[model samples]
Target chain A: MYWNADLECVPLEQRRELQLERLKSLVRRVYENVPHYQRVFREAGLRPDDILTLDDLAKLPFTTKDDLRRTYPFGLFATPLRNTVRVHASSGTTGKPTVVGYTRQDVDIWSEVMARTLTCAGVTQDDIIQIAYGYGLFTGGLGVHYGAEKLGATVIPVSVGNTKRQIMLMQDFGTTVLACTPSYALHLAEVLEESRVDRTRIRLRVGVFGAEPWTKQMGRELESKLNIVAIDIFGLSEIIGPGVASECLYNTGLHIFDDHFLPEVIDPVTGKQLPPGEEGELVITTLTKEAFPLIRYRTRDITKLYEEPCPCGRTHVRMSKILGRTDDMLIVRGVNVFPSQVESVLLEIGQTEPHYLLVVDRRGPLDQLEVWVEVSDKVFADEVRHLETLEKTIQRELESTLGIGVKVKLVEPKTIERSQGKAKRVVDKRDLYNRDK
Target chain B: MWVKQISVFLENKSGRLAAVTRLLADHGFNIRALSIADTSDFGILRLIVNDPAHANRVLKEAGFTVSETEVLAVEVPDRPGGLARVLDLLHQAGINIEYLYAFVSKAGENALVLMKVEDLQRAVDVLSAQGITIQGHDVVHQI
Candidate 1:
């Protein structure tokens, strides 16, 4: 279960020393090659030599997605294109995509880290991994693919889409490990139930889900639905891709691959570092990324960091599941309505599926929050009174939990749109009012 | 005698009831009697089909939440107060009728009524002691 135990279980003191050394070298590399970091360092009146210990990481200039956007294509690459082996770009739905390059060593490190990710979930060489993540530009598919291959597991490079066929191959190939987004895993579970193939025939035992913020409730839902141990993998294209951190079978939290990625939580507005267990925006500094090393990159993901060693014995720092993005927090009627909070309520109430969509609309002055919950077999009752009672209970639960009155709408099964990747949680129709204004 | 009644849960949408009937009809299962307990959002279609077990299995396999409940089917006297007489008997025995639906029979002169009661065994005892004919599966299946 322990992949590269020496590095993973390195003593705390030794690990910090290693991190300090790596951080210093990464700063020097970026300072020498990437002009953006050089200019930012000059602006901060700091030199690469100033990065002495790991604690000095906070003093380094922060890298934002805007910074990555400013340096579009190869501007941030420390190594020349000839020296880099692979390049991956994030989905630039908001604006131009942020690109990242990796040298051969970086890719090898990615594979090793990803191999640790697999091993965290109890995956081994005897396991057959079905990679359902999208392959090309999206690093999730290939990142896991290379890692699974490196782990000596039989890799079924079945990229996303064709859900029915995905289920068929999953059963036929006897897949022992499934890798995809949490939402996509739920979608696959739904399809598997609706399909003719027997679930007992399927050999999937562990799921490596990432690429979007999902709830612990969703993680439990995935476990029960797919009958697999769900492990959460955290990574971004700006860093290295799907191997930055992972949840072991212990599943207390994701253990950041301490040897490679240095994680810190900071107050979003103040940018001051928050102590362990304080929820804030997560900032990560790549310690060993060669082709694209980042100094204190703002990930925009909100979560607390736990430096305590995991019961699984990995010395890497652990992090809570990403609560909500600092930028993507949905505010309706002045209440922060995170889809994960709504998800926890739904799953805890039981009977309803872990699928729901939040619709925020402004009628005149007040915003209306309508939750569309998928009625599953358990939620459905032959008696109208029973179903009505369930609806009322959900409304009451949401109102009490969220501190905002919500209209609960019970929709038919399979009515809500499911994503093959990250799920669409909210539909902000209040944009109509904004548009007209 | 207890008769198996299958209730299917469905969303209150146009043609949903028709869809359930169509599924049953396609499967060659004849509905002996039926009743719709509806609200604005959903409806529970209670049915007395020719084959309760098969109907329940097929309906469930088709993604419908189906459950079977046992109810007593009684033979009512072919008179003006036929249904009323049966209700009066149950009421006199202090047994509460949960729900009652009419089941017409082509093979018999007396009308058949399916009634679910709170105390099922006691209701059967009270009806049988009053010399009323409690219809069984053999009789209900023929209908």
Candidate 2:
């Protein structure tokens, strides 16, 4: 069995040779095993032998989200269901959730990737890892859960919610490393301060957050609150889970596990591949996944790909933090708006709950957006006039941040629907077909 | 003396007024007089409509956050001094006007003024005793 090494740290010539060899084997496996790949290759009128190097990767058919959804359930799994040890799914906002499976070997490889990520972040056996992400079909909680266990760190699988208990566990257990979504981490920090808990006394040193696209401003806020180093972890359930790549302590781009997953940047509109340092959609192909292998799956996440060696000495390809999903982009009154843009503005206006909903609808020929924000009791006294003033302030801030006018409705705290699992932040009521009419 | 009064909660957005108008139209109701008491985010769209109960149900069914309120619709002369007389009466009675709007009556000689006051019953009693003709619920529906 050939084991993959961190070839990016090795000499440039050696890394290129290794990548070329892996690329050739990956193409052969897809052509020989996957029926979809075979049909695509036949339609393209190209033989598997034509793709013998990394340069030939362009010849392969690009997989997309539509393909994954059309397959549904498990039509794309390369191995039998019995061989699969784990399954994870994305929230089915548009349609049926995309299901992904992993065999025993695949799970081992996932843990190994996460272990490398944690090790790169300076986490060791002496660290106590607190996993705050939710468990179950969602991969974030358990992905970090097992990865910490594999690294011989004391794992606290305290899933999401119950911030009071999470804070208690952090203080009592002396959690040195935290893994969670960035929003929840900030919520925890808020709860900690409200409860008069000294943030430094908890002894948290490092945090790995993902599962939602967060900005650098948010990362800095989280770092300042918890007095810990915050790093971004990147992955998707279709490709793997939370441990596909992670940022080092340097807080640059996340390093990809190029040995098992091939990363590429492509123009979202034309599907043409872009060169390094250019912003585009991140595409990945599972090189060694046996259970639910994906070939050149187009992730709608927008980011840039970098091939330059990081200061941390990892030869793995690097990806910048994802800005937003192309599918989630909202066009309100002929202007584009991302939920993260709203989130950034909310963060700056301290003492506000992160829970918010974007209501999009068309009024006559013009599109309108209303942001329902949950008001914190400290800022407003729950009176109608006070809440209204807060709403105006939110509207002004959002207009300044997004450069588009939006009406802000101040809802009572917890009035917005809470997500038991993956949160649905956007509620678009615009009729796309009628808009043209 | 009573007038048909209807209250509706409206979030501040463009075309929201159109939505309210369409709902009332679909229910075969017509606005007699209307006033909007607003804060920044939302407004209470108070109205004296053709049918209060029917308008309220239609607004609710249309998913608009709405409520019903009893406002006073005082009849005044079509002249400019007519509104001033009613305002002077209310001010003397210590009644605070939250908001008010005028309606074009069919007779053209008399105008209907919809008034939302802090105290509904007290204002009605004060206006009725002052010889100001309070339009009945039937006259409101007839409009």
| Model 1 chain A worst lDDT window (10 residues) | A428-437
- Residue-by-residue lDDT tens digits, candidate 2, A122-220: 888899999988788778888887778888899999887788999899989999998887767877877787898866669999988887666677678
Docking class of 1: incorrect
Q: Please give the range of 10 consecutive residues that has the lowest summed lDDT in model 2 chain A.
A: A428-437
TM-score of chain B of each: 0.95, 0.83
Write out the backbone clash pairs for model 1. none
Q: Kindly list the interface RMSD, in angstroms, of each predicted candidate in the order they appear.
A: 2.3, 7.2
The true-versus-predicted C-alpha distance at residue A63 of model 2, in Å, is 0.7
| Model 2, position B142: C-alpha lDDT score | 82
**Candidate 1 deviant stretches above 4 angstroms:** A329-437, B1-143
Among the numbered candidates, top lDDT falls to 1
- Model 1 residue B112 lDDT score: 84
How good is model 2 by TM-score?
Answer: 0.64
Tens-place lDDT digits, model 1, residues A104-145: 999999999999999999999999999988788768889999
